[model samples]
Target: PEVIYLAGIIDRTPSSIAMRLVNFASVDPFHQNRGIAGLSGGKKQVEPIWKEFIDNKEDLLFESEKILAEKESVSIDKKFAHMLIGIENLVGESKTREVKVRVNQSVFRQIVLANYSSKCAISGIDVPELLVASHIIPWSKNEKERLNPENGICLSSMYDKAFDKGLIGLKLDHSIVISEKLRSNRIKPYYKQFFAPLEKLKIASPQKYLPKPEFLEYHLDVVFMK
Candidate 1:
């Protein structure tokens, strides 16, 4: 349905839209590493756009959303009205900055959700409201990779807070690791039901943009509780 909707807006067939996505997969490092090949002929055509996304994700993603909104005959502000609430009074550069941040954050969440098939990587929770686009590296700590899909993980709200607080972490192999702080509560029912089961368990692999090893290492070194 989404492909058909996008195809109608772009004046392309659904097959073509799907093929374009495949072309994107062709250049994706995750797919390439897994030996999956997309249509080779269109790979070159998508390379430049992919490179641009890698270089300046914030601008590219926001502009892409704006373009989509325009093509659908809607203002970007209207399209994202739900997220723009409470920012109406601000004017000038501050307003622009805040809007961009909110929109980009929305885009990041969408990408992470799509990558994980809209399920939490740890708990497999499929409820959208319960999910979060958890950053492996603290967002404030890494500006360059702030919007990188490889730096994000799909997690339930409980695990997201746990991760953010360094109460849980991921090993390089993608297995969950419980912090000693969390393990200290092993005798508690909540710990028995939640934290204990997750220890050393592998997270579900994303469809694309697997978390980068470097980002995981950074989390382990700086964010993870020893």
Candidate 2:
């Protein structure tokens, strides 16, 4: 029933629906390209649809990245592209949906990295290998908003742990806000040295990914552990 309900809102066909699902799963364009192209060519009509979706989806993704850098929302068409991703989930029995979600997810990470200069947005620590573009909103919680760049943050291993734990959080204004619970004598000096300085840290100047306040609120209430 839910899938049928989901199908009503789907604007694209089943194959395209599958493609979008696949795109968000891995976040790798090269992989997605290979997978999308692997489908049988005898289905000529689907080809055009797939091609259009690929082009439009890439365009929309890049546009979203640009807006994230600018700390703004994508233009209307671009926004529609994102909104239309739901169609991918309803595409009959096709595998494209699974692959699309993966590819797009990879792209999302790259966008977040570039936007934050491959560094932790809060601590200014630059360690590409150890950093992750962590989601402000967990992926399982909101399917419609999952691909959104604004729902993510770039943080190093330690800081991500702290952020995920809610030992600290960022103000809507991007200033630092250490949870009052963490201000105790048992607090690690490392917290004082690294995270404490962050209390005054200006939210990283958004490049391609301004943090979304709505998801940030989720962090403050649920995921931030504090």
Candidate 3:
């Protein structure tokens, strides 16, 4: 998530990312001795395979709990503070800034995936690593929908970025709408090649919480570039 939100790379959920970390730990040479025994079982294996984990359960549990909290979507307050600090050099990042809200990213993802069937609304990319929960209404614009899953859509990274930049948007009928700028030859060839064809393509319909028409309208009128 640090890589995802902060750096905008490696589009994956916390759980999928956690598994990758576990795989890396298995081969990490520095922690070889401390690492759990590999599959094929330890030599002579007198103790149970789960012994190490069982014995350290309390310590591991505590650490896992910390990770879980971190995995949850950041509180809206923390998110705002972080953004403000980056943009305005906010010192101490104001924990008391009345807008202290946290966003549980995992929960948000779950809700978005539930709505969009765990795939990009435009491209239908099923690979979890390439997907993001995009807000139909910009996060800063709608405080109430900051963590509201109904306000989110599962979009691939490219589409997400384009949508955020107002280069593209969803029509009232849920089709993709490419902005006129992207259609200009002045734009890169790839921009026209990639986005031009998406115009009027109906996005995958959400199963449950269809994005509120007002939110879509807000994006179209306020956020989308004409």
Candidate 4:
């Protein structure tokens, strides 16, 4: 329940355990890649705890990791369900819904990652830590599209941020669209070598859940800088 208790068991400081959980969540290299939002604080902390457990799950002594994984998964699922219902019921009176939103975002990322085969659609970066589940339409623009995998794309973190800030966009053909504004920064080696080279390069489309054209249209109209 308390970090002190966990610290004693693990022979780590309370603060160290807490910080290490963040590190564990940061680099899962496994199924789900959790950002700080999904991995830090309260009920969502269980996700990171599981992330740590998974890192050490390969025990030769016994199936300790397997046991903990199943146990924690069940507990987290039940607790998360109750937490969501509670937050939904208390929407106006409390801020618990924010936690639910974080969980939803994490699940949304997992779905998008699966859709894109856990690599960046544009750069083909396979490192989970470097990829992001980017929304075609800005998340703030469409509530319904927030969790829709068909409205998501896997992009490397740089490309994701670039797409978000509209340093780049996608044409209807799923090709890269670099903004003319980048011309000023084009002197940067990475800009010329990596970013500029991406212009007109086609993004990798999902095999199972193709992104919606309307979402692409919305992104082009509202989010894309040019």
Q: Which candidate is the best by TM-score?
A: 1
Candidate 3 stretches with Cα past 4 Å from truth are 1-103, 186-189
- Displacement of residue 161 (Cα, Å) in model 3 is 0.5
Score residue 206 of candidate 1 by CA lDDT: 98
Q: What is the Å distance of residue 65 in model 2 from its true position?
A: 15
lDDT of 2 by residue, 1-226 (tens): 4334334454446665555545443343444545544334334545455566455664566454445434433443353354345454565545344434555676777778888888888767887788887888777887656666788888888777777777778777877777777666336987668766777677677675578888888878886645
- Error of model 3, residue 179, in angstroms: 0.7
Model 2 lDDT vs. the true structure? Answer: 0.65
lDDT of 3 by residue, 1-226 (tens): 4534522233567665555555544543333666564333222342342355345543443344345445565543443454334334333545333222322444566679868888999888989889988988887886556666557889999999989988888877888887777667436788667776687899898886777788888899987889
In model 1, the clashing pairs are: none
**What's the lDDT for all of these models?**
0.92, 0.65, 0.66, 0.70
Residue-pair clashes per prediction, in order, are 0, 39, 13, 0
lDDT of 4 by residue, 1-226 (tens): 5677667655678987787666555444432432244343443556555656444432311233223335445543344464355554455525443544655666678889988999999878999989899988878877656766778999999899999988788878888888888766899997888788787899987866777888888888888878
Local accuracy of candidate 1 as per-residue lDDT tens digits, 1-226: 9999999999999999999999998888768889988877897799998898888988888889899999999998899998899999999999888888889999899999999999999999999999999999998999889898999999999999999999999999999999899899999999999888897899999997889999999999999999
TM-score of 2: 0.54
Model 2 — which ten-residue stretch has the worst lDDT? 71-80
Put the candidates in TM-score order, highest first.
Answer: 1, 4, 3, 2
lDDT of 4 at 6: 62
Better of 1 and 4 by TM-score: 1
| Candidate closest to the true structure, highest lDDT | 1
Give me the runs in candidate 4 sitting further than 4 Å from their true place. 1-73, 77-95
